[model samples]
Target: MAQSSSKRIFLCNSCGNEYFKWHGQCPACSEWDTLSEFHPPKSRRKSNGAPARKTTKLHTITHKKDRKRTSSGINEVDRVLGGGLLPGSMILLGGQPGIGKSTIAIQIVAGCGKSALYVSAEESEDQLALRAERLGINTKNLHVSGENEIMNVLEQVSVVQPSLLVIDSIQTVYNEDLDSLPGSVSQIRDCGQQLLNACKQKGFTVIVIGHVTKIGTIAGPKMLEHMVDTVLYLEGDERYDHRILRSVKNRFGATNEVGVFHMTSAGLEEVTNPSELFLAERTANTAGTAILPTMEGTRPILVEVQALVSKANFGTPQRNTNGVDSRRLSMLLAVLEKRLGNFMGMNDVFVNLVGGLKIQDPAADLSIISAVASSSKDNVIADGTVLVGEVGLTGEVRSVARIDQRLQEAAALGFKIAIIPKGNMKNVKSFKGLKIHGVKSVREAFQIIF
Candidate 1:
């Protein structure tokens, strides 16, 4: 039997939808000019020989009691990866351009103290070396290659048999057999799958750096995320020096773990105590400012929540927020008005999370309310006081998870007092150096803050 000729197909880069021909707009994602031509993989020919029968009994299979983990020399990254990275795991790490994705990848290889191969599709080996040198990474066991072709990289991988593999920017790599340009939908999917298969078979850890679209999402087929063992995202704005490595998906460990890093001239530096860094410049006795302890996965972080309420300069008082959702702010403001009888509809309110960090945890609700109320009432919350609680729509303060962790973090940071939900008071038996004030309602919290 002869092999059939490969047929051409059009693929939507936005949604990975395949079509017979290119169209002006992708019907799947409704994106314009995202369709590109590519040749799909040819079907395998039927084999006359019988397929091999393989079976393994559960009792006969050997089970390893503990997973093999290697430290990546970066404490923050390791924490985000559920303590350490396991062998034979394929991790896809994505970030915006110049957001230290490559820096952290190299740091991991250098810090592991193992034989490693760095494959760069976007830059040359010399450029990688220069970056390593600047970061003070001098590992003789670490090797660098600048090949983009998946087959050639696999050949090198087989020859080197390195314990760790780093693929810089997977979008730039492609398979020669795939009739598509690099960074296209087909190229990213194919290259990622091939690399993942090779790494799993070879019993090595592969960290693939990926590019993000303008909308701050991983660029490529959504299936690309499903094919990997873990998906890590390096999040932070370029205008700020702090970067957060968050684990959105982890097969071997818990997700939502965050590792904090600071961008420095030497490279990305691990921040052991992010709470201190976030509150370092916080001014004392500020009317619109309130300190809040929020949990990021297992770690507790203390950050300042600030709100400014002023008379509206024009009609339709603007309600603005940065780092906190505007809708959530509106709800909190409405609660304050309805419960505390503080009229905010006629005033312009602005809420900001200091240090440019976004907070999704509902525990921050009470802190935001406190700050906004303090600004509105022209009163300053007592210094060295921390707040943590969730505000319900019915004017009651709800208890948040891990109250002990938040209290411990506040105590460690020299916070003397805490305003928390009354429901959490039952969970705390003793916490040294911190005073807890429990409030059943948002009105009670406001009375205490004032």
Candidate 2:
């Protein structure tokens, strides 16, 4: 076999396109100033004629009995993983610097209850030990190392032969063969590929911690995300103690699954019932407030939607929202003004979802409109009332998916009344201690609530 010489090339960080020369704009993605220098590893070729690779028929391949998933010892973590962690799978955990990425990673490693190696490229062994102690983890099976060299780390892995391997971060480790510095596009791609290969061959689970860019995406080429088996993100506001662990991509589990946690003095504690936690501090019988039953993956949760409308202070009415889509709020406001009257056009509107949860459920559309209308009219929605439906452009209340599940969750939380889309009424089986009101239009809903 002969090794081919490696060449320096340019790569677009946005689209992962290769270029022989640097350009201000990437030709593939049309993104400006996203190209960076990269050195691809040398390739090996056989001196003699190449032989055909072996192949196996898909139907003939049998599943291994020992390939079953094992619990990570954390119920919330296992839930996001669709039950448990599978052996030989590569997972990526990414989040902001202080948003508890390392905390959760260490917790998972400690809870795996197996011989594990923790490779920390950015922290010392002492720092890791302190963190483990603070989290009340005292396990002899977990080994800590401060190596950042990719080859040396692999050598340690070979020596340890542990069932689990964790890389504190993918950005700080670099391959010696590549001239690019650590965290560079070339280093991340090459090192990540090497880890993936090792995970597949050695049959040990690997969890790689990755940093996110300012835009909240994992920092690296888009291909890096495609190389992992699962991608989890830790998100929360610095001002709040609530944290959300969400799965955006998963090969074995359903995506968009979320696990709620609260930051405590000791460590992150899982919230068993997020609905109760989110509505714990609700002000009863308050104007500009509505309850919405939304679904996160297969779990149904009730979140509070609040809105405030005031007279415009400036030339134009100010429209601001937190944890709610700005465009959706604008459209809802327009609907309220056109369908109802010009009340909102002359007022400033602000809508916020309690508990720092950002929801994309269209079932919240009716809730948002209800809250906004309640604030504008200075009237409070009745106690123990929840709204679930999608508001269309023509002010018609549209049906939402999983209406039965949403209503059942609301009912379990002691919600006495529910305003749902008329189209979904047939799907409701009726629950004890709860009353359902079906509305055909937003006007009808207002008439009933007011």
Candidate 3:
């Protein structure tokens, strides 16, 4: 038979956009070096062994479906994974180097108590065993292999037939059929597709550990996230002992849920009461500190927001922020200077969310503004007061989501006063053992708190 001729094309791994030729950057997503040479799917030849069976109707088929999930015996991981691990589900876990990605994977396998196969392209078998021993995990059913070739890993999977399969650092895995090297756009895409297909064919749960880029995103094509059933990001500053496991995308459960863990010499341990842990060492009456009740998915956590305003000797004032967006800090500063006539423009300001946990909740806006104001005036806020509300560009305070939950958490944490948006106050009948102060604008918030 004559070989079928196929045209060569260039594809953007980020947006799935194809181009006639290669370019330095992807025009669709503006990501540099994301375009790679594409290969068309090879046609499969039919075997001479058996004939194809007729398709059955959906209603006529009778199957015993098992919807039960396998629990990893770790409450923090279970929470982030939405109860437990579902069979045949593909999960992509991404994190920076030395962020306990492998530690968590081995812990989960040990807790599952079932047969598990771990394939690593980054670490040696002896290295994995040593870490596992240090973590106090002794699971006889867990199998380990150090294979970089995708085909060989699949072959081992066939022989073992384990219930759980884990791939350490998917970027290191490469398919021999692909011309591109490992970690390239084409190799990552092809290897991920093949692993996902194999997982679906076999009834086993698979978790793929991924490397993050310099910008803190998963080091692979954007389609790599879309192809998985769940995408989780393990985030936390290396200098701090606390780590947060956050779910960015989930097909089977809710997203934006977070799991807090503290790194110990043994391994990662779950923090049941994150609010207490975050505010344990906070000073009683600090000028630059403000506590805020923020919601992390279904759970409410109270975190301290600290700010510092100092005179800048240089011409250009510096704006530094940790565990928060710098752009957001700049916007808050502009709002303060415009609406409240604050002297934030001439001074250098630094804002930090305590415990090294990143917060995207807009409800903390009021707390941030108040912290800056408190620092500028050098006046400490009253003890047991928690701020919760969003600040609009027009200086008006906006209502946040889950107001009741936030108030309840604050009250349970021994907070005596709660400052919230006026809109959120009208709907709340009452808060137990807590005083609710409603504010319509940033000026009103500062007057009530500062």
Task: Name the runs in model 3 displaced over 4 angstroms.
Answer: 1-8, 25-27, 30-32, 38-65
Taking all chains together, each candidate's TM-score versus the true structure is 0.91, 0.94, 0.92
Show pairs that collide, candidate 3: none
Question: lDDT at 323 for candidate 2?
Answer: 86
Using lDDT as the measure, which candidate wins?
2
Error of 3 at 26 (Å): 2.9
Error of 1 at 315 (Å): 2.0
Least accurate stretch of 10 residues (summed lDDT) in model 1? Answer: 44-53
lDDT per residue as tens, model 2, 107-178: 887787888999998899999988988999856899889999887888888889888889989999988877
Model 2 poorest 10 in a row by lDDT:
44-53
The predictions' CA RMSDs to the true structure, in order, are 3.6, 3.2, 3.0
Q: Give the number of the best model, judged by TM-score.
A: 2
User: Taking the candidates one at a time, how many backbone clashes does each contain?
Assistant: 0, 0, 0
TM-score: the better of candidates 1 and 3: 3
How much RMSD separates candidate 3 from the native structure?
3.0
Candidate 1's residue-wise lDDT over 201-281, tens digit each?
668999999989899889988778888989999998766899999888999777888999999988899899999989989
